[model samples]
Target: MTTVVKHATIYTGTEKIEDGYLRFDQQIQAVGPMADYHPLVSDDQVFDLAGQTIVPGFIDVHSHGGYGFDAMDGNADEIDQMVQKMTANEGVTSYFATTMTQSHENIAHAMVGIKKAATKNPVIQGIHLEGPFVSPLFKGAQPEKYIEGPDLKAFEHWNELAGGMIKLVTYAPENANCAAFERYCLAHGIVLSVGHSNATRAQMKQSLATHVTHLYNAQRELKHREPGVTGHALLEDNIYTEIIADSFHVYADMIKLAYQLKGADKMELVTDSMRAKGMPEGVSELGGQKVIVQDQQARLENGHLAGSVLQFPNAFRNIIKFTGCSIADAVKMASGNQAREFNLTQKGTLEVGKDADLNVLDSELNLVQTFSFGRSFNPENN
Candidate 1:
């Protein structure tokens, strides 16, 4: 059976088409002007969007957990609950099961859980290892006891436990023996992202040369003399940067400046949400460490940011409001750019032959409906 979504303003994430229509089976079959597409339909389920905006479903390259469940728990039932919560409420059709920095044994255990969850849930893209090899000076909320120097044996052990589903890894480029680790990751088709570091400008640049294509612009700040990680992220043209875009993680002015400098093609928005995301403020556990959530910010006892309680939808809205970017541009940052960075060819755009993963939003940027693999799930039912 085919579904015809008509009378919508389509932001393909690459282009905008007014009064457009899209036809799909399990994948997008056609996208074009409504008039040109009218004759292509026959006995199809038609949904008149009534001018609502239709865009590719948001893809989060980095996110930990949400809806009172932590991805690091390594529980299949708990991970499924997290996926349903994110997909039903926030329109995240696909995401990485991110793990926090933990002890070697704990990280291995978490990878086992992520592997099981990915096998059960098709939307679980892959695993993203976010620590264990990072600087103690900029560990943020990561437990100090779990922080370790760069060790290939540990990586190999984790990879074996994960059954080789680890798709992305995050590490401070300044860590000891990082150059060898970077080469290993690149050789194995794993994406290496720099994050949670205090590397200077020259150090950051040198690290980027070592096959680090992505940067996590979460904790570091910009400085004139030091430049820091954030400066290299903003000034570099070839690197893809992930911004929290929650207005609290990064200032509005800096968000706007990043958009201006990198454009929507190279900037991706991620939530980095914690277990308390989409829930009330209170105490929570991030990778077995205590976290206090107050006023939507998750922090450790030492005043370091633990993670976030913001969802991808809120991040999208904040990006638009803060940067004055078009809805299309904001959507591109959340979907298209992420797909490009991760080399996911068939999951990002609304073009023909792509997956039928899409989000339908009202005029005010509120999610009205979503489709994952042609199965429509309404958040109102939740």
Candidate 2:
């Protein structure tokens, strides 16, 4: 049976339809202005979303965990619970279970758990390996002891344990033997992202990484004489940069500057959120380190920033508030860009044949509900 949502303003990722209607069942069957909406069957589950807005569901490719669970826990049940709560509270229809730099055994265990959970939860699109191959100088929340240079064999072993579900990797460009690792990732469908690095602009230019993780954080900064990793990210036209748009992670002006340079198509808004998210401010754990969550920030005891506690819906709203971009442009950063960069072929847009992953928002842009693969979830209820 088909599901229909009509009388809503729709941002289709490619276009906007005022008073539009969407038809779907697992995948989108049709999308157009209300004039083109026609009932194909009488039993279609029709919802009148009058005075509401719909857009492609937000996708967070660089989140660690949320709702009191970390992906590194290596517990399939916990991972499932975390993903479900994330979906309910943040309108995150799709997510990447990002892992931190950890011991070989621990990382492998996490891979196995994520793989197992993914079999039951399609929301777990893939894994984002955020460490074990990063710069110790910029480890941030990542433990320095486990950080190492790029090693293809180690990654292959972990990927094998993950059932080949490793979709993205964050490694410093200055690391040794990166060429081979980059080639392997490219050949196998893994996206290489540069992060936690002290690499200079020239070094970044030499790398084949098309994505930058949490731009301007845990990476080399822009300098007058040497445009570091941050500068390289801003200068590159093809790079897809991830920004943690929580007012705390980045200032509004910097986000505006990035948007001005990269525009919405090249900049992706990621939560980069940790287990502290969706919970009250307090102590939390990330990558074996104790973190204090307060003032909307998560930080280590040494005053270094840990992961974030930002929710996806707030990130979506912040992009607009900070950059003054339109809903369509914000949609690109929230969902469309990640889909295009990660080759999530069936997602990121509202059109015929795409997955029915979308969010419904009120007049003020607050998420009212979400439909992930044709199943409805109300945020207020969660």
Candidate 3:
């Protein structure tokens, strides 16, 4: 059966169309002005948006977990529940399951479970191996004991254990063994993101990698004399940077500055949310460390920023609030930019022939409806 969604202002990520209509079933068949309207069949379902905003389903390139479930917990049931409870309700149809700094054995164990859980789960696309190969100097919420430099053999073994589901790997370029590991990642079709490091400006320049993880939080500052990772991230136009935008991770001024410098094209808004998300304030766990969620932030017991309780919808709204950017530009940062980053060519943007993964928002930017795998579900009711 085909569905025609009409009477909405649609932001195709890069462009906007007023009074548009979208025809899709699993994949978008056509999308344009209502003037192009023609029913595929008499039985085709039609949805009247009544002047709402329609955008692609938000894609989170980096996330830990949500709804009281931690991705690193290695629980298949939790993954299943998260898929239905978190993403379906929050309009995040796709995401990466991010891991944290832990022992080699523990990290491998999480990968093993994530691999099995991702077999057919629509929400989890790939694994983001965030640590055990990072610098201790900048290991924010990661356990210090488990921190180490680039270990190619261990990484390869973990990748194998993960059933080759690892897509993004974050590491410090200051390590001695990084070149070989980077080579492995590139050759294996993995995205190597620089993060959790105290790398100098010269070292940052040498990295020339494509992605920077959690900009400014686990990273150093942009000093006049020393420069550093943050400086290069601000200056370089090629590398895409991740922004928490939760307002707690990075200051509001910094967020505005970054947006001013990078704009939506180079900025990818991520949640970096943890198990405490979608849960009431209290104690939680992340990478075996106890976390406290209060005042809308998640932090380790020792006062380090653990992760976050932010969901993608709130991140989408917060980005607009922080940057004062257009909903179209914020949509790009939240969805299209990440889609282009990971080659999810069919997954982002509300365009003809793309996947019919999209969300509908009311006038206030509240998620009202979601279409994932071509089925419409009320986000609030879900």
Candidate No. with top lDDT: 2
Clashing residue pairs found in predicted model 2: none
C-alpha lDDT of all candidate models, in order? 0.81, 0.91, 0.85
lDDT of 3: 0.85
Reference-based TM-score of each model:
0.94, 0.98, 0.96
Q: Give the Cα error of residue 71 in candidate 1, in Å.
A: 1.1
lDDT of 2 by residue, 273-360 (tens): 8989888898888887899998999999999989899989999999999999999999999999989988899889998998899999
CA lDDT, candidate 3, residue 131 = 83
Candidate 1 Cα RMSD after full superposition onto the native fold (Å) = 2.1
Candidate 1 global CA lDDT score = 0.81
Per residue, candidate 3 scores C-alpha lDDT tens digits across 1-382 of 7888898999988789889988888888888989888776553789999769999998887888888787778887777677666556789877788988887777888888787777757667778899877888898998898888888999999999988888898888988878889889988878988889888988988774778899997876788797778888888898899999888998878898999999889999888988888888999898778898999999888899988888788888988898899998998898888888888878878877888989999999988888887877775454
In model 1, how large is the Cα lDDT of residue 327? Answer: 90
